[model samples]
Target: MATLKQVARWVPSHWGAGHLVLAGFLALLVLAVSPVIKLDLVVNGLFLGAIIGLGAIGLSLVYGILKFAHIGHGDFMTLGAYFALFLLSDLFPRIGLTGAGLGPFTFGYPLLLALPLAMLAMAVVAIALDLGIYRRLRRRGVNPVVLAMASLGVAIALRGVVQIFWGGGTEQYPRVSKLFYRLPMDVRIPPDNLFVGGLTVVLVVALYLFLTRSKMGKAMRATSDNPDLARVSGINTEHILWWTWAIGGALAATAGVLLAVSQAQLVPIMGWRLLIPLFAAVILGGIGNPFGALVGGLIIGVTSEISTQWLNPSYKPAMAFLVMIIMLLFRPRGLFGAKD
Candidate 1:
């Protein structure tokens, strides 16, 4: 009741009014379809959201801090999964650990062990890209449009490199065929999906705490607020930038591995397809707000699944695009974005 009253008392400014409108929309949606909300839709939406949200965190951070849209971030997702796949395929079994994932997951212990290495590798790759390309451009004082265009070119080159190494055909994890379980409400929950979702929650919580409480995390936020101000205040903006890539790259890698586990297949172009939705999520959540990624991801994910009821399932990918368009139409700053 206290929370309800507090919410009721929120002043309806341009920024706050959007919140109330969004909340009202949700309330009306619940009231209208209280009965037909399928458990599967909820379950699927959650893990899918988890996957997208995890990756979006990285993309959001890069955009917020560096002020450039990283078109190559999605490629990190594909590369990370490939890294895990390379290690876990026959090498793990050769070293004597089989691909029998803990208790029913299609992903195995060896793959889990490979996760950190993939993260580290991806982080190194991110920083290297910064040094190799972005740093030089910034030093030359090029506009952000130039940076964005360069990233798009880099993304295409990266995609081609991945295709050359991993090949175009889809590849599966060391061949695990297990029975996926469905709950009482006709809700099917895969073991790997549950694990990924749980991990995402934990990471998000840790990130929130870190950003709010830790020194470096707060510095990152400060840099995002004003790089010039942060530099004048004794904060090393360059260090913060490097660390941003490290964290974002690590998270992107993990999201990729989790996505592979869920689909039971890996392909070079998989992450490419997921990029549009990720961009949508980042925009919907607001360009620089990490928490908004969580909220936006859930809305986008659940809406994509549930939208199938009204539109064709084949159009599911367009749901994020539609949401982004609507957001741009009304609340251009996004749900959590600070009002100008």
Candidate 2:
């Protein structure tokens, strides 16, 4: 192992120091652009950030624990949305609940009910995918790149299945009139936006508490930090894997549902389109750091939205792409990336 002094010396020489420079630049840029940035855009950006963060958390967790890039994660989001749609539109109607509106929200109680069920269902699917595909590959000692490529195939398969079943058109939950709440700076936000942001905060807090205070959660952290050491310490890495997938899948489902509600529509490719931003957040936040994902998501969302001032709104995703490229070039480890 390297000495403390050597490691300390290495830090300044590596890309780690670049992140500090990047941070300073970002701060300066924000200051320069603050006056032009509208409050409504910021509010919309937060809502977008919540969605991106939610998805990125799961992706980060999976990557952290499993040490592989999961390209199927975005498609999993699509699956979750479709699963909730099935419950709300098909199942609930048969049960005498037409998913009527719940107060000022756009959807109904049935959707709230479907949310957890969809999460559970997605958890099962994630575990099944792991057992069926990823586990087999791991046993064969395939590389992480192979696993990532396999996930690409999985992504393609999932999207195809969705297109076949739901058709290639857009679909949405049962709709009610949306209500907006006005805040200062003449910003108007829908209840769904608040719901998305609030739920994201709750979930992030719950994840933090779980990781810090719970037994299994601690084991997960250990595994993420060093799986071999964790396994040698009598931790059941297998169980950790299961829990990671469960949480990841459930979070993906929640993000999908939230995105569907906020956007008022869902298409098979919606998650695919969002995948770049999600990865950008993960890379920007530090791969495998869930909290980093949250922070990165918010920054990406806000910057992407605010860039509309100068660039076409259609290029929002390009903004995320740009951030990712910059990080890859200057600070590949990201802001909160763990030192090796």
Candidate 3:
């Protein structure tokens, strides 16, 4: 008991006030809501939140490094999904890479095989966009709004190409529905979504480690913090930009695949439709704060998902918008988004 008291005395003093109050408030809310809310809804919300956080991380990174909102980020998601679909549904069959996947998963070896290729493809595409359009604008010192508008044009063109090739219909991976399981809480868990959640956690941890431990990662942070200062310090800003887009594109592509697995189908406009929630997560977490994006995604996703208990199911997206508005009105900097 004396040792415990001594350790407690050594702890930070701020824990006695703001953090404790917030913790107490959260505890009270959880206690109040736990009894009435279904456990299944909570599980579903958390799974969805994981995917949303993954999507927002990429967007946050781009905003941090590029200093502009890419309005067409949704289409990048769509592109990744469709690319994966093509590889799994078409290329894999042609190449005879068909085989069994891990037991209990709905996806066969084809979808598994396509995952990395899809990420690579998307990263290349992101680099191309920077080379072809964004870099030119940056050279001319054009405004960010023009870059945003240019992104919209790219989005339309990309969507049109997808429609022209794959048509405007829905597509999906094969044999996916057999992976659902019922848990102790009477929650119907999709194995794919569970995998998504786990993968997202792994990715986030890996990213955090990279950012903290790797030299290039430190350079990226320095660039994001102050590009001019970083350049003056001999950090190659162009290389940092390349890495930023590559990481963002890969993450976004992986998130697209995760979402596709969860829903069991894909449409061309699916990513576009997801843009609002993604943006909400990004802004809510703070415009360029990756860790904040994860927390924001959880908050937005859970609130949106559990909202079905009272509001119409169609109002889920509206909940995110409402949350963003409230955050803007109160904490414009977001939960952990204070600029360094």
Highest lDDT against the true fold, candidate:
2
Winner by TM-score: 2
lDDT of each: 0.82, 0.89, 0.81
Judge candidate 1 against the unseen true structure and give its global Cα lDDT, from 0 to 1.
Answer: 0.82
Ranking by TM-score: 2, 1, 3
TM-score of 1: 0.91
Model 2 stretches with alpha carbons more than 4 Å out: 1-33
Candidate 3 residue pairs in backbone clash? none
- Tell me the deviation in Å of residue 182 in model 3: 2.0
- Write one digit per residue (lDDT tens) for candidate 1, span 1-340: 5564355345444446356548846764684357677757866877898899989988999999999998988888998888877777756778887666577776667777888888898899889999999999999999988998898887788878778877899987775666778777677787788788888998899889989999999999999888999999999898999999998889999999888888888889888888877888888788888888777777777778777767888787788889888777666777777777
Per-residue CA lDDT of model 2 for 105-126, tens digit only, reads 8888888789999999999999
Given candidate 3, what's the lDDT at residue 157?
Answer: 87
Instruction: For residues 1-340, write the lDDT of model 3, one tens digit per residue.
Output: 5664455455444443236337634964694367776667777887888888888898998988899888778888888988999888788888787654456777787776688888899999999999998999999999888888888898898888789989998887765456468877577887777678888888999999998899999998888888899999999899998888888888888888888888888899988887888889998888778987887787777788878888998898899899898766645556666633
**Segments in model 1 whose C-alpha atoms lie over 4 Å from true places:** 1-33
Cα RMSD to the true fold for all candidates = 5.4, 4.6, 7.1
Candidate 3 overall lDDT versus native: 0.81
Error of 1 at 251 (Å): 0.8
TM-score of 2: 0.91
Total backbone clashes of candidate 3, pairs 3 or more residues apart or in separate chains = 0
Worst 10 residues of 2 by lDDT: 8-17
